[model samples]
Target: MAELPDWLRSIPPWAFVLGFVVLPALGFPISLFYLTVGAVFTDPALALAVALACMTANMAISFAVARLLSGPIHGLLHRRGYPLPQLTASTEWRTIVLLRASPLPWLMQSWLLALGGARFLPYMLVGAPVQSLVGAGMVLVGESLFQGNAVWLMMGVTAFLLGQAALTAVRRRLRRRGSAY
Candidate 1:
């Protein structure tokens, strides 16, 4: 990846805290990318801390975005000629939970929440720990892989991702069935 701009580096530590730390809480993808990159280049401890912090930020942002977009998102979906069955259905809680618990890409959840107009508070409440745990696990696996422990690292990451995918698929199926109730 290209180096962060010198101007970005020149920004005060507080700026990094606000942009990377605070903004990500709002479900911004940049934060996740930043955390992952940091994990790749830094020590595990730092990576873990950054991942936790990013997760916190993601929750805060998701909540605020969800709350604010509730009406607008509904309207936009209507205008865009898309079905609201998934978004407006009562399946959000389960869907969000499964998404959070899964090892699928973090951005998928963030985008779903953002675009679906899910409730911000609930999304954050559900998504924070899920993202954090997955992220930390990814970092740990990455570290091990970097250290030449390819078997363990590959196994761990594969297991986590597969588990997440299974859970998400099952939750989606259940949600679809529940919507018929």
Candidate 2:
């Protein structure tokens, strides 16, 4: 793995965390790509840090996408005279929480939420942990692969997928119940 610059190494953990939470929101895919690479090649501690950073970045991007869609996207749809319902109204906290917890694609979830008007803070709060878990799992999978433990690597991937599936099911159940209220 390429060593980070002295400047980056000198950055405090809190600053790294904040940067992770902000840059991705600004649509910088390079940060996510670099973090993924770091997670793949670095030691576990560094890999974990990279994974967390990437996940944080993802959450920020998701929140931004959701917020933007809430306004401009809504305006565009209205201007087109489409029969679509107001997407902004569907972006309730409960919906965002459920989506964050579910197995649906992250980018898709972010786009939908943004178009639906979910608030940034709530989305970030709900998404950060979930994304972190996913990112950490990815790092672990890479480590297992590097160790030439194909069996263990496969197991890790399977477990990750299964956990995501289970979470998605639970989120669906919660959504159904919430909607019934």
Candidate 3:
């Protein structure tokens, strides 16, 4: 396997933790952290927890920032011809889940949730778990791949595929039931 760069090796654990929590909110590619955190932290479970916590923190930060700049963001989107979703209490949960499940970037998801007027309670409740779970799986899969462990890699990929299948089933059911998210 390839060795981590000297600069990466020199970073302290605390700095890594802080970077994991802050950089994504600043529009850094979160997958860089998700995929490499295992190599830094060593312990898979601890790495998973740390990634989840950082992701949740990033979500909150993104939402707060989006709320603070809602007017400007709305104007920008309006100029770009993108219509914001109307998130009612009834649709907020599903919409939040769908957004989390979508392939959109982390910051975009949070911004949409906040700018679309999702309630704080449902946003955290539905958004955090869904994003965290998907992110944690990425960490696990990444860890196994980096470690060259075929079994764990297969398990992670299988679990991810199953999760995607379940999500697709849920989407179909909602569509069949005429639930507008």
CA-only RMSD, every prediction: 5.5, 5.9, 2.1
Better of 2 and 3 by lDDT: 3
Query: What is the per-residue lDDT of model 1 for residues 39-76, given as tens digits with 9 covering 90 to 100?
Result: 34455577567656756775666556555665777788
Pairs that collide in candidate 3 are: none
The top-ranked prediction according to TM-score is: 3
Q: Judged by lDDT, which candidate is best?
A: 3
Residue 35 in model 2: lDDT: 35
Give all candidates' CA lDDT scores. 0.59, 0.59, 0.81
lDDT of 2 by residue, 1-181 (tens): 2343333446665566555555555555433443344333346667577657667666666666567556666678789995344334344665665666555665666766666656667667766665555565666666664555576467557757865885777567777878531
Q: Which scores better on TM-score, 1 or 3?
A: 3
Order of the predicted models by TM-score, top scorer first: 3, 2, 1
The TM-scores of all predictions, comma-separated, are 0.58, 0.60, 0.89
User: What value does the lDDT take at residue 159 in candidate 1?
Assistant: 49
Q: Backbone clashes per model, in order?
A: 6, 1, 0
Model 3: which ten-residue window has the lowest total lDDT?
Answer: 1-10
